[model samples]
Target: MSSTELQDRNVAWFTERPDDSQLSADARHLLESYSRIPADDVVEHVIKVRNQAWTIFPYPCIGQFRFLDMSMKYTKEYPELLERLAKGQRLLDMACCFGQEIRQLVADGAPPENIFGCDLREEYVELGYQLFRDHDRLKSRFLTADIFDESSPLVKLQGTFDVVYTGSFFHLFDYANQVKVSTAVAKLLRPEKGSMILGRQIGAVNAATHDHKTNPTGKMYRHNPGSFQEMWKKIGEDLGVSFSVDATLHELARDHFRFHTDDTRRIHFVIRRE
Candidate 1:
């Protein structure tokens, strides 16, 4: 699709929202935890913030309220992960649109000082402070910089994080740009054995680059478990760092906007520095 067509589609999607009754369990929990109170007011607040964010970037996660579903919360390793974070292990939420995951981390008792969020758009980062209503209380830092720009301020974060979480991020680019992103993430992670990257994104049963309206080149790579593993293997080889990728593909919920076709699944991945 052309750039104009993509923009029009985004505009259309921006106006869509789930009804108040449709709010996910996680969304409700977060609203109460953050004192967004009087259930009715919380629902309105979520709709307004989400609609505004959709205008900025019409990501499916934003459109479907998936941002409230913290990826780490569902992981089998959550107990251990929370323990480590509370003990001061550093975490970076890459391309963290609105820093939802970071806020969830704070809600779960992770030390705010040890959490960080980075995204290319400063607007999104700024909005996060408002959405979570924690600008003053939350100690986590939010950086604005392009991940693909080697000289961008993001480079200052190299080798700084113990865990990097990237949700609905990597699949936005083609294979080449995905490698660039993975390489950048690899650099940001600690060299210690346990440092890793984890998140979920749209994946395909048969991995391949497909036409995507968001890309200038009109293409984005979708991966299955094996292909995702291989992509990380190649990144490790190029960086001369040992790493292992464990990925799983699961059927997306029927209500998910991305579940338009049977070929699409949600890919959950963990790339560990070995």
Candidate 2:
């Protein structure tokens, strides 16, 4: 079959909702956006990232449940921080994929006015803004900005935030860029015990460095959790602040490849300076 045919097939499969009850308006819109994209732009390589599941299954988002499930599992590691966020603490959700975690923060009681988010993809950020329009308590705003762009809007957001948070974006940069981002994140802090979250693929025996080739478009840089830890350790040393791995959120990433076992991947982190 042609790419268009394959695209149509995938669209047909994804159109079948898991359940009307499981569907949110934003979720529906996401699915619709997926359908609207041309088959030529829908690269086969992306399917490989999730182990062909997006092509084989009817799911709207990859690892949707697993991401939240892991977050709940590692609750203890971030209790103090999460609790503080729950109590109207200001937050900046950098490179927030779909803003679900931001929603969770609002649900946990973070003030809406205090939450700010940005993404390189405008559609994702736009979706987030529309999704949270009804909630006055979660007046979270989303903007379009490339984190790597030195003059991006994010770099000029007037003033620093109370807590600058980034979950999955760290692993998408090389070690040097990660360090740059760490400094940028630090600068975004209000100079009052600021903290950020770095979640990356980690292993005991392996040192996670930059993995720049996994993405098909050659636009993303990735790292394992260990690399993130090391980056922060160096940053902490330079900044004269103590830093440590707050928790290792394991079984958090799922790869359906037959060669990998259940203990394979994780979304672990280092929480410091708060």
Candidate 3:
């Protein structure tokens, strides 16, 4: 659909439109091939017909529907995070889906050059960078990197950031993978000086034991946030990192989006090195 249509429906409004008139012959060929389908068909095909696209859209990707409101709520509740940015702290936006946090931080006075965002899906990252690259407020860089891949571009990076943030990415993996990711994040930070904020989905039960829900394409993923925290703590111990529970959003607010399960609640934690 058109950008206006997506925006009206509360979806990620595509700000970058490939200009057919400006394209060279090769570029035009690619554009024609890619945009062959009607706008509405493109949206429906990706959002409903494709499996991976289904999981990434309108949900964790924050591509549409009340995402902007939730982004504002998170920064509002965690003023400390914003204050840290004012102090020249470098920030890492890990698993940053649509780069809303990066945009928000820059808008809130963060030096864009000091901020970096990484996501596994290049499509999302490329779209974000293209749409947000020209903002006068941000000097930050966005990269398409996989957090779970040890040898991915994210792992190859050299410097430690003052703040590393991930929103609702931890619960997507299994317990063992969660532990691995927690340890990796710790290792990426400097001991004691680095702070990590996680917007997590927690359940009262272990994630593995919870009912498996299928995406539109039938891929089963775990959504146990409570058991997640307990297992994550043990994982931190094993990795020699000390993480503390910072805050919890008890699902009492209707403004919060349903990330995993409609019954699922949230926990926000600020972790530091032991």
- On lDDT, the candidate that comes out on top is 1
- lDDT on C-alpha atoms for all candidate structures: 0.79, 0.51, 0.51
Q: How do all models score by TM-score? A: 0.92, 0.62, 0.64
lDDT of 1 by residue, 54-120 (tens): 6676666676676777667889867767888988899898889889888887888889889888888
Model 2's TM-score against the true structure: 0.62
Per-residue lDDT tens digits of candidate 2, residues 109-163?
5566677777776655544444334333346787778766788887776346656
Give the poorly placed runs of model 3, Cα more than 4 Å off.
1-66, 70-77, 130-138, 202-229, 247-249, 252-262
Cα RMSD to the true fold for all candidates: 2.3, 8.7, 10.9
TM-score of 1: 0.92
RMSD of 1: 2.3
| Alpha carbon deviation, residue 257, candidate 1 (Å) | 6.1
Ranking by lDDT: 1, 3, 2
